[model samples]
Target: MNIAIGCDDAAVELKNTLAKHLESLGYEYTDYSQPAEDESNLYADVAARVAYSVAEHKHERGIIICGTGIGVSIMANKVPGIRAALCHDVFSAIRARKSNGAQIITMGARVIGSELAKTILENWLQADQIDPSSLPKVQRINEIEDSILSKSE
Candidate 1:
């Protein structure tokens, strides 16, 4: 599966480590992250790119990193059809995919170390998606999204 990855300056090192790990696992990924020295690439900018990739079906999943993960998660979820989850632990990461069918996982560089982040990433990657019985609930989420977007126009 093709994965999209991006991060801000604060998370550059962790992002790099994750990218290498993905490579070792034989996963194809697009890197939307900017260098640490590049001040122009903001978290929202990078988050939008990763979120859009999955939303457009160009990628199956994505990983985004920032100072606290919250900013990127909030920005990614703003896009229609994108379920971005901010996970700092293994359980949350598992639920992000297994329960919510999130296509993107966001992590915090300052809040979690590289090893824990790696573990979380691995667990999330291995988790199965939402169960078949949960399809109706997932559909309801989509319906709510459509209803909100429709009334806006």
Candidate 2:
């Protein structure tokens, strides 16, 4: 499957590493954001581009990165039908796909080590998406999220 990747300055290094991992996994990707992060980099643009690209790509998956992964996740979620999850471990990453149908995964450069991030990505891609009814964790989280979403609208 084709994947879209985006990252700000703080995550450029990690993003590059992920690119290699994606290549090794035989997944094609398009980089919407550049490699440089000096002082002028803003994650909003990168997040929006990645989100929009995923929307446009039709059935493709994506990954986004930022300093804490929160910024990119927040930005990506603002777009319709974009379920972006900020994950630091295998369980969250795997469950993100399994329960939420998350199209994009965001990782924090400062929050997780490369090794852990790699493992999370690997499992997330392969794990069976759990049924919403069978998993209370998934059901409750989505319910809470939906409540918040309803209030926001």
Candidate 3:
């Protein structure tokens, strides 16, 4: 599956590590990360880019990173139809996809090491299909999103 990956300056190293891991796993991915020197490269912007890419079906999934992962997760979820989950463990990563049908996963560079991040990504990748029983829950989530969006419009 093609993956969209991005990070802010604070998580550049972790992003690089994950990029290499994706390569080793034979998964095709595109990096949307901005140069560290770019003063306008905000975490929220990068997160939105990745989130929109996945939401538009430009990529199958996405991985976004920041110092604490919280900023990116919040920003990504702001986009309609995007379910971005901040996951620091393998179980959360798996459940993000299997239970929530999340198309994007956020990680914290300062919170987890490269090895653990790789392990989490591996498990998340393996969980390509959501649990069948979670369909109703996922549908409800979509309905809620649509409701909120329609109200705002």
Top TM-score hit = 3
How many backbone clashes does every candidate have?
0, 2, 0
- Which RMSD does model 3 reach against the true structure? 1.9
RMSD of 1: 2.4
lDDT of 1 by residue, 1-153 (tens): 889999999899999999999998888899988643654589998998889888999999999999999999999999999999999999999988877889999999999999999899999988867977767887898999999999999
Where does candidate 1 have its weakest 10-residue lDDT segment?
32-41
Name model 1 segments beyond 4 Å from true: 35-39
| Cand. 1 TM to true fold | 0.93
Candidate order by TM-score, decreasing, is: 3, 1, 2
Candidate 3 lDDT, tens digit per residue, 36-149? 455467998899889988999999999999999999999999988899999999999999999999999999999999999999999998998889999899999999888999
Residue-level lDDT of model 2, residues 1-153, one tens digit each, is: 888998998998888888899899987888977634553358988998899888776537788989999999999988766789999988889878887778899999989888787888888778656666647865666787778789989
Candidate 3 error regions (>4 Å): 35-39
Q: Which pairs clash inside model 2?
A: 9-37, 98-129
Task: Report every candidate's CA lDDT.
Answer: 0.92, 0.83, 0.94
Give the TM-scores of the predictions, in the order they appear. 0.93, 0.80, 0.95
